[model samples]
Target: MSSGKYAFTKALKELRFHHCQTSPQSQAARSFLVRAYPTMKKHNPQTPILIREAQGIEPKVWARYGFGKERMESLAGLDEKAIESKVTEMATSEPQS
Candidate 1:
């Protein structure tokens, strides 16, 4: 924030919305984000997103599981290297539908 390295941190920062467990809006948002960038939900949200020149790291977003407060998958962090690796993994892991 101080560096102005990140803009729209409010919209894109570590959002603690339990996408899988509640309101349609959040669910839709999470769905859209996942489809656009499927690995956004894999890391701990409290994890610091630090980077040297990847512009800015992606914020960790998380969702809660069913019922009472269990965590679900995250889109993971957004560093270039981490994103690359995650993309590779997702590519390999996809069922090719």
Candidate 2:
């Protein structure tokens, strides 16, 4: 019984470590995406370097002003609901000339 508990604890620790590593990778990816894709770097020109790392459809601080596959793929892992919400948010938040 104690061995089983130890194994579970060990597994959880390993999972946590993996999660931590993936987080930085995703953050770096997001940062690189913002810079490599022009549209993403357009919005809020003052802080073009701000990279959004949220999982849901929050307006990416980087690519809030343009449209394309670059935008879609930046949000590729989000679910339908989150994507819809992001679309709505983007639609509402666009700056009017």
Candidate 3:
């Protein structure tokens, strides 16, 4: 029999499951994310990136795991550059694997 102590704990990072609509603005954001993805992968390669056409909606971030408490973050306020900056900032914060 094994000891009572826990085996291990793994960090379930909030995946970037982006829901983008079919529009000029959403398309732009999608392009920007596609470009920035490789850089993010260089750090957290396991980070899942999925894109789906969300009708009548602007580009937004939603949860893939955990309780649904965090508000849906709209990409409306951010341009392509802002998106790149945010991605870069997040990549830097993660510990290099």
Candidate 4:
């Protein structure tokens, strides 16, 4: 599945997004979801994209890969574009395991 400059790789199993609904640190994550979620979901129907919201929690993006491997990235202090780039990198790259 392709979105913008990134394509979803087969190595990726799932994507988990963590953010606060109304916190400054989470703004970019929320923006990323708003702008990219639909396209990503439409293109990669088989992949699970989970969004978790909580109060005061740090914003983050997680990529789960095969063999129980996973990667996490902090989203704090980033802009929407940066968040998108980070997510794309995570989604397309192979897991270290």
Candidate 5:
């Protein structure tokens, strides 16, 4: 198998592992699931077209799960600190449980 295919396979395995570990009630897990489930349902493509287009390789399972150059770049640019601060502010302002 090629390096790209190997990497894609590795990533898919890791995602599945992580997803299995996520708790339904945890805010972080719920947030991730909420975002991911819809995308998975809506797209339902066998392979990531984005990766295939960008890498000139056959689309792999990992790509179907949304790993690609566009996603990588967007993730790299994300300001985690800012996002955390916003989440913190919103949580604090909301009525307590």
Candidate 6:
């Protein structure tokens, strides 16, 4: 699926984000989601995008690919731009062996 600047690849099945809503470490992830969530959801309406929050957990992002394969990256201490770049890359690229 293609949206203005994002073209999600077919290999990507779902995206999951986990963060602590009240922790400073989650600040960037929250900010990135605020601005990017709408565009992502609009473009890939069928894909599951889940956001989970807790009280003191570390922030992270998960990308699930075909055949139940998955990859995860830490988001703790990352800035909004870095988080965006990581998510864009994960969302657009195919699973790597």
Question: Quick one: best lDDT, which candidate?
Answer: 6
In model 4, where is the ten-residue run with the lowest total lDDT? 1-10
Point out where model 2 deviates above 4 Å.
1-73
RMSD of 2: 19.5
Better of 1 and 4 by TM-score: 4
- Model 3 spans > 4 angstroms off: 1-12, 62-71, 89-97
Candidate 1, residues 17-97: lDDT per residue as tens digits? 223334333344344444433233333244233211122233333422223332223343244444334333432231222
Per-residue lDDT tens digits for candidate 4, residues 1-97, read 2455556899999999999999988988898798888899888889999999999999998999998999999999999988888898898888885
lDDT tens per residue, model 3, 1-97: 1221111112324445364556765865787767755554455555565566776667765423334422235666678777655544443343233
Which residue pairs clash in candidate 3?
A: none
Model 3: ten consecutive residues of lowest lDDT: 1-10
Q: Which structure is stronger by lDDT: 1 or 2?
A: 1
C-alpha TM-score for every candidate: 0.21, 0.24, 0.56, 0.93, 0.23, 0.93
Each prediction's whole-model lDDT (CA): 0.32, 0.31, 0.51, 0.88, 0.27, 0.89
**Cα error, candidate 4, residue 57 (Å):** 0.3
lDDT of 4 at 35: 81
| Residue pairs of candidate 6 with colliding backbone atoms | none
2 or 4, which is superior by lDDT?
4
lDDT per residue for candidate 5 within 1-97, as digits (tens), equals 1222212222221122022222222334334344444453344334232211222222111221223321111111224343233322322232222
List model 6 lDDT by residue over 1-97, tens digit each.
Answer: 2365456788999999999888888999999898899999888888999999988999999999999899999998899989988999999889988
TM-score of candidate 5 versus the correct structure, residues matched by position:
0.23
* Candidate 4 C-alpha RMSD relative to the actual structure: 1.8
